[model samples]
Target chain A: MGNSFFTPLSWNDTGFILTGVLNTVTISLVAIIVGTLLGLAVGFIRAEANRFTNILLGGVLDALRSVPLIIQLILFSTYVGAIGHPLDPFVTGSIVLSLYSMAFMSEVFRGGFESVHHSMATAARSLGMSYWQTVAYIRLPIGLRAVFPSWLGVALSVIKDSALVSVIGYMELLRTSEQLISRTQQPLEILIGVGLFYFIVSYPLSLYGRYIERKMAI
Target chain B: MEYEFHWIIVFQKLPQLLNGAFVTLHVSVLSMLIGITIAVLLAIMKMSKARIVSLPATLWVEIARNTPALFQIYMAYFGLGAFGIHLSPYAAVLSALVFVNAGYLTETFRGGFQAIPKTQYSASKSLGMNSVQIYRYIILPQMFRRIYHPMTNQFVWSILMSSLGILVGMDELSGETQRLQSLSFRTLEFFIVAAVMYFLITKLVLFSAALIARRVFRGDL
Candidate 1:
């Protein structure tokens, strides 16, 4: 049996783990940024005045949301490889994660956009602002703030769900910990350590989510 | 481009796939039932005024909620074996699902609990109802009503999340589909079928939950 309380973490090993952490964070951040933009566009498309456009965007979002992320990852990887693009696991995983996050984030932004008072948009238009300017100057800022809490929820979920990429050999934090545990045969220590790493990443976001909620409430 | 599609393989594997779907459904339903029980207890503990009780419950919820269900499953399956506690693959998946679901459900229930006005509890006390009576007759019913939609959403999520059980060799729907795909080498077909099955199951579960909610909260509707 291994030591229970104090299995030492070597600095060399910690460096490797930190690299995995960096990879995970980089993938998540890129996914979040791209996903949020795509989601905003889709959300606006769904909320567009044209009925056919609204249905098309709504259908796309529903299809994305209904499928499991792991399956989506595998499908994307296989299709990309078949097309000869042959992305590395990181790139493929980021694309999949971004697409997945876009579905949920679109819902969040849709709720946000809907919460913008109709009168405000009208007032902006009455002041001779173009349609684009009304949305950019008046609707988007307030709408995003209104949905900030929900966006935070989606962001936290994306961070946690990004762990699924390890299944496809992404070599992120979870995969690194799995490799370490297998080599060291210290499953508990490694699992707990990985859990702690996850906590460090997620707890701050959760606290910030609460802070946003409080600020919005005020 | 004369790629012949094989409906025969899908037909031949239907029985195995159905059996796997049954296992998936069984595990999800059982875990959800157990998880909700644990969640209710944890929610109550979280609401407790005592630091000792709330502290541990808070920690458990935070750890479970923040970590991926896949990791939790690995810990239950692989980590426990290091401590000489070995669970079957299905057992490990079930227990992990319960643990993870409990964390989310506790939050959902607590939200419901908080939504209840303090005056309602005070009024129950004023009517000379004991704590048990108040909880059973007053708080629980209303809490259930408020949490119904979220709980339904959670159930759908759990069903989809159960796909992870395939990683640990539980021959759930995803696992069976994966095997079929390997044999037939029809990746898109198998995945598209599996995705449709998942969508169907989720829609069925959501429809039933909506029906139940309508029955329970007809006046509110």
Candidate 2:
């Protein structure tokens, strides 16, 4: 080893790492927002629909959830490219991540929706509110509040799983760190820095997840 | 559109793919077993009133939980090499996985232990049992019953995450599939097969876990 204990990090390289961090966070946020909405829609469709629609939607969700996200990413990337469909890596990662999150989020929403007593909906309907009005004004709010904690868990998972985007050359934090290590041959310092970066990002969410669980428990 | 689905290429690669599946199964099962041992120890340590025990366990759990499994694997595989401690790809992946699994399972088991009523412990202690005996007879069994579902869920998660070991050149199912896809240039076929195999194995693992959980926690389930 050329340098002892503390070799200074080049600011330029660290800047590159920071940009990667921003990409990771952006992808995770977009995935969570879009995924939650899609999941809520699908989950309600499954819950409120006839047997055929419920089964169809449930089957789709199960298939999506069962396949590993990494494999799904590869499949989507290849299939899209093969079909002569041009999409950017960021867009591809977001789409795949959103689909992945939707699988889990739908289950969360389903559980939440079920927790809202049927009487609530029936009462709202009897009060001259339309079906859509009851869902929008009454049921969804309560259901979403109940599901918030689980959604937080799903969000944390999404953040970590988004690292898989590196496989498709997303140049996220993990990928950037990998490149830095290869170039600088400073695996220890870079890995520690990268690990710390992940810790900084994930630790707060984990604590917040626990906080949500505790608050929900109350 | 011109590319054909080559059944011949798939059939020829089936044996090699099966071998890869075996490797995947081996790594997952071994890691699960090792992980449970680590988890149990960590759980006990976390629950222990002693600071000496709890502090390290807490730190380990926090660090491991916060970092991604992929990063952990890279650190184990590459970080240690810088310190003149090199592990083979298999060993590195397994160790990293065991560490990751242990972190998650510790929380699961801790939750299970917490769910047990304090009176149960008191009753066991009153029955002329020592600490060890009380733990063996009362706490451990009850903990498993309460956490069986979550523990099994973590096991499935661990299996899925093991696919990441392909990064370290473990040549598991995903690794083998990537190789086949490259050689045959049948992207869809090879990947579709790999995906189906993964789904089936995950289902099998989950099913067995559920069955075992039922048997163990018959009354609770």
C-alpha lDDT (0 to 100) for residue A54 of candidate 2: 81
lDDT of 1 by residue, A62-89 (tens): 7778777887888788666665677899
Writing each residue's lDDT as its tens digit, candidate 2 over A25-107 gives: 99999999999999998888777889998888887787777677788888888888887785799999999999999999988
Q: Show pairs that collide, candidate 2.
A: none
Worst-scoring 10-residue span by lDDT in model 2 chain A? A1-10
Name the best candidate (by TM-score): 2
TM-scores for all predictions: 0.92, 0.93
True contacts kept of each: 0.53, 0.57
Task: Note the residue pairs that clash in candidate 1.
Answer: none
lDDT of 2 by residue, B1-221 (tens): 44456677987899999988888888888888999999989998999999999999999899888888888888999999899989887888788889988988898888887888899878988889999998898888877677777766776776677788668777888888888888979888888888888888888978887787777777566
